[model samples]
Target: MAVQGTPEPFVEILMSTVVALVRRDGPDLSARQFGVFLTVYLGEGPHTVRGLAKELNVSKPAITRALDRLGVHDFTHRQVDPKDRRSILVQRTVKGAALLREIRAIMGEAAAASDEAAPGGATELRRQHA
Candidate 1:
C-alpha cells in the first residue's frame, strides 16, 4: 500500500531503505534516534546534547530521549564533557559505526533498486553509503 503523500524519488528510496532496516536483525531505531545517531557519526564531533539539539532543531529533552534509546543499543554513550564540566557529550561507539555502515549499505541497495524499479528516477544516491 502506497502511503498518501507527495511521491518524491528520495521518499521512495527512504521508504525502501527503512523497510530493509526493519526487516533486518538489529536495533530498530526511531526516526529521531536515527537522526541523532547519524548526526553524531557523520558530522564533526565534540557533540554535546546542546549541540545536537541545536543542530537537529529539537529540544534538549527530545535529544536526551533519543540518546537514551541509542544508549540502550550501545550505539552511543553519554559522557560528562570534561572541558565544560556542565554539558553531557554524546559520543559515538564502535557499534554505532557498524550501524552507520549497515545503513549506508542498505541505502545504497535501496537507491539502486529505486533506480532500477523506475528508470531515470534520478534519485540521488546515498552519500557514498557513508
Candidate 2:
C-alpha cells in the first residue's frame, strides 16, 4: 500500500490507466466531459446543471456544454424535474454503465501490467525515478 501523504504510486497508476484508456478506440471525451460523466455516474442523483456547476467549480454553461456532448453519445439524458419545472435532472443510461465497466476493466488491466513490469511494483518504479 502507498504510504500516507505520498501520491507517487497513485499518480503512476492513474497515468498508466489513462495511457491504456487513450490507446483504445472509442468515444474520445474531453476532460470536462469526462469529469461530468464521472461525477454524474459516481455521485448521488438526481443531479442538476446548477448543482453540478457548483460541485465542479465551473459555470452552468460549462456543465451544459459537457452534458450536451454526453447526451450526443447517449451516455446520459436530461429530464424536466417534476418538482421544479425550471430544473432538469441528469440521468444515467445503460450504455453509460457499460462504458464505465469497460473503463474499469481497462484500468485494471493497465494496473496489473504496471505491477508486473516493476520488481517491487509502483514502489520500485518510484525508486528508479527518484
Candidate 3:
C-alpha cells in the first residue's frame, strides 16, 4: 500500500498488470517473447531478427526462440526484405494488432485504477516519466 496521495511504485503497477494479463483469456507470452513483440509492434517498424537482437541486447537465437512462440500465434511473421533479400523483416499481423490493443487497454485500466487509489499518480507511463 502506497501513501494515498503519492505515485505507486513502478514495480507494483507492473506486477498488477502482469497479474491482470495472466488472468485474461489469451496466449501467455514469456517476458522475452512479449518484449520482442512489443519492440516490433510498439516501436519503429522494418524490424529484423538482427535488429531485434541488437535492440533487446540479446542473441539472434534468443530472438528467434521468442519469434518462434509469437509465430505460433501468428502475432508476427518474417518476410524477406524486398529491398535487401539478405535481411529478414518482422511483420505484424491483424491478430498481433488486436493483442497489442488488449495489452494497452489492460495497462491503461490498471493505471487508471492505480490513479484512483493514489490520486496524485498519472495514468500513463509517459506522463510519469515526463
Best by TM-score: 3
Model 2 residue pairs with clashes: none
- Higher-ranked by TM-score: 1 or 3: 3
lDDT of 2 by residue, 7-113 (tens): 55556778876776788787889889999999999999889999999999999999999999999989999999999999999999999999899889876776666
Off by over 4 Å in 2: 1-6, 119-130
Q: Model 1, 29-92: lDDT tens per residue?
A: 9899989999999999989999999999999999999999999999999999888889998888
What are the clashing pairs of model 1?
Answer: none
**RMSD (Cα, Å) of model 2:** 5.3
Q: In model 1, which range of ten residues has the least summed lDDT?
A: 121-130
Cα lDDT for residue 93, model 1? Answer: 94
lDDT of each: 0.87, 0.86, 0.87
Clash count list over all predictions: 0, 0, 0
